[model samples]
Target: MSWTRKDLLAMRELEAGEIVLLVDTAASLQEIATRDIKKVPALRGKTVVNLFYESSTRTRTSFEIAGKWLSADVINFSASGSSTSKGESFVDTAKNIAAMSPDVVVVRHSSAGAAALLARELPCSIVNAGDGAHEHPTQALLDLLTIREKKGHFEGLHVAIVGDIAHSRVARSNIHGMRKLGMTVTVAGPPTLIPPFVQELGAKVSYRLEDAIGDVDVIMMLRLQQERMTAGLIPSVREYSRYWGLTLDKLARHARPDVLIMHPGPVNRGVELSPEVADGPYSVILDQVSRGVAVRMGVLLLLAGRKGGDGG
Candidate 1:
C-alpha cells in the first residue's frame, strides 16, 4: 500500500490492509528503539505538534518520544497553557498553529468530532490521539500488534474488553480494528455502562465478568473512567470492581491459564485490576506501552512523510 491518506483519524475509516501495513511498519521500526543511537533521519525536517485539550500521561509522552526518535521537530501544546483556556476557539488556535507549517498535528480533545473537524480544516496531516469517547487509533494499533506478537494471529481470537465501555475510546477503536482484522470482540461492563447498539459495531455485549473471562484468549481490563462520567454509571468504584475487576482469584477460576491480561494504564490499582494479575506472567500491559511508541512512530512516518518520498 502506498499510503494516500492525509490523516489518520479513526480505525473505523481504515482498510484492513492499511491496518496490517501500520503494524508491519511499526514492527520493522522497533529495532530503532533498541539500537545504541536510537535515532532515525526518516522525518529529519518534519515538524509534529501535539495538540492536547485534555490531561494525559502515556499518549502525550509517547507521541513526543516517537517524533523525536524519528528526528522530527516535536512541540507539545496543552489547553491550560495555550490560548484555548483564554477562550480561543479550537479552529482559530489550530489555524494559527497551521500557519507555522507543521507536517502533522496530533490532537486530543474532549469533543467527539474534534479530530475530524481538524482534518477538514487543516492542511497538515491529522492524527487522532483521542477525541472525547470516540476513538484512540494508535492505542488500538499497539494493542493489535501486542496481540499478534503473543497469539500469532487475530482471526478467531477471542478478546474480552472489560469495563467502562460506554466512555472508553480505547474500546471503541479496538472494536472496529479487531473486527476488521477478523477477531471476536466481546465488550463486558455493567448494563448502565455499556452503550446501546454497541453490538452493531460487530462486538458481542456481556454484563457478567465471569462470563466474559471464560476461556478467552485476551482479557483487556479498562480503567474506570471517572473523568468522563457525567451520570451515575455505577454506584461506586468498589461495587464496579466487585463485579468486574480482574483479580488473581477470578483469573484462576474462570480465565484460561494462558489468557493474556492487558490494560491501557494509569491503572486503577485495585479497582479495574488487582496488583497480582497486573504484574503476573500472562500480563502484557508493559508490552502494550512499549509498542505504543513504535506504533506512533510508524503513524507519524507514514502520515507526515511526503507521499512522493521514497515509496512511503
Candidate 2:
C-alpha cells in the first residue's frame, strides 16, 4: 500500500483496503497487549512526542501506552502544564520538539489542520490525535473496530451518529470510517449543529432523532463539545435534550434488541444521552476505549514501517 506524506488529517484521506488493514492489524496486536512483556522491538530507540494542546485523558493516555508497547520512548507536552499556555506558536513549539529528534509526533489541538501543517514542516511522522471539530481519525478507527467486533462486519449496516456534528472531530472521522467500510451512515442532530452538505460525504442526513435511530445496526452518540459551545448554538440543556437527546424511550423506538450503542469518552450524561442507555446492555462505549490502545499500536506500527504495510 502507498501512503501519502501528509498526516492522516481526516478520514477522507483513507481508502477501504487501508481501513481494513489497520483494523485487522490492530486485532493481531491486541493479543499481545495483555502479556507480561508487552513491549515490541519494532520502534526501539525511537522517540514519540505526545503534544496535546487540547485537554484529554483517554486519547492521550492510549497513545502514550501504544508508543511504549512498540518500545518507543514517550514524551508528553501538554498545553496547560507546559510552555504552550504562555502563548507559544504551534510551529515554533513543534520545531523545538523536532530539534530533539523524535521519530513521530502525535498531537491534539483545538484548531483544525494543526497536525497536517506541522507534518509539512517536520521530518518526523505526525499522528493527529484530534483537531478542532475537524477530525479524529484514530478515535474513529477504534470505534470502527469495536463496532465490527460486536456486529460481525461493516457492509450494509445502518449507523446513526447523533449529536454535535459541527463541533465533533470524532463524528467526522466516524463518517469517513463507516462509509469506507460500506456501512450506511446518518448524521442526526438539530439543523443548527449539523454541518451543511454532510450527505455529500456519502452519509444520509437527518433532523429527527427517532427517525434516524430506527432499525440501525449501530448508534454512535458524539460528545457535545461544551468547551467549544458559543451563544445560540444551543439554548439550554433541558431544551436541547427535548429536541435531540437520546433518552431510553427514544432508543426504544429504534430497538432491534441487538442494536449496538456507542459513545466517545467523558460523557455528558443526561444532556446528549441518558445514563440508563449509556450503561445499558447495548452500549459499547467502554469497549471503544479499550480497543483504542490496539488501534493506536496499529497506527504507530504502520507509520513506522513495521510488519504491516504502510497506509499510503
Candidate 3:
C-alpha cells in the first residue's frame, strides 16, 4: 500500500495494513543508526517543525534527531518560551508557524484535539506526538517494532498493560494498534485508575496485577502520572506499589519466562516498576527509546517526502 495520509492524528483512525507498513519502514531504516555517518538523504530538503505546547524530553528530542538523521532541517518550538506564554492562542501561534511553510509539523499539546485542529487549519502534514489522554501513534508504532524485533510476530500475542490506564495515551494508542494487528490486550490497574469503558475499546480489564501478567507474552508497565493523582484515584504510592508495582518476585512467580517487559518512559522507578526489574534482562525499555527515532524518521519520510508536498 502506498502512503496517502497527510496527517497521523490517532492510532484508532489507522488501518492494520497502514500500521504494518509503518513498522516495516522503520525496521528498514534502523540500520542507518549503525552507519559511520548516521545520515540519509531521503528527506534532504524537507523541514520538520516540532511544535510543542507541553514540555517533553523524549518525544520532542526524538523527533529532532529523527529529522536531522534524515537530513531534514528540524526546528523546535516550545510553548513556554514562545508567544504562547504571552497569551497567544494556540490557533494564532500555529497559523504564524504555518505561514513560514514547513513540510511537517509534529505537535504535542495539552488539548485532546490539538493535532486534529492543526490538520484542519494547516496545509502542512501533521504528526501527533501526543494529545491529552487521546493518543500517541508513533510511540505505539515503535513499541510494535520493538515487539516484532524481539518476539518475531504480532498475531495472537497477549500484552498486559498495567498502571494508570485512565490517564495513559500510550495505553489507548497501543490497545487500538495491537488489537487491529491481532494481539490481545489486558489493561490492569486499580478500579479507580482503569476507565469504565476500556472494554468498549477492545481491551480486557483486570483489577489484579498478578492475574494480568500471568500467561502474557508481554508486560507493558505505564508510568503513574503523579500530576493526575488527585483526591481518590489512588490511596497512596506505597499502597499502589505494594499491590500494583512490578517486582522481580512478581516476574519470577507469575509472568512467563519469555515474557518481555516494557515501559514508555520517564519511569517512576519504584512506583510502576522496581529498579531491579527496569534494569533486568527481560526489560526492553532501552530498545523502545532507540526505536523511537527510527519510527519518527519513517513517519517524516512518508508524510513529507511525497511529490508536490508543499505546505502553507
Candidate of highest lDDT: 3
**By descending lDDT, how would the candidates be arranged?**
3, 1, 2
Model 2 CA deviation exceeding 4 Å by range: 1-6, 81-87, 227-230, 306-312
Off by over 4 Å in 3: 81-85, 308-312
| Order of models, best TM-score first | 3, 1, 2
Model 1: CA > 4 A from native:
81-85, 227-230, 309-312
Report the number of clashing residue pairs per model.
0, 2, 0
lDDT of 1 by residue, 1-312 (tens): 867899999999999999999999998998898999988888888899999988998899999999999999999998854446678889999999999999999999888989999999999999999998999999999999999999999898999999989989999999999999999999998988889999999999889999999968999999897653447667777788898889999999998999999998889989899999889998999999999999999999988774666223
Q: Give the Cα RMSD of candidate 2.
A: 2.9
Worst 10 residues of 3 by lDDT: 303-312
Cα lDDT tens digits for candidate 3, 84-170 = 568888989999999999989999988898899999999999999999899999999999999999999999999999999998999
Compared with the true structure, model 3 gives a TM-score of 0.97
Report lDDT (CA) for all predictions.
0.91, 0.84, 0.93
Clashing pairs in 1: none
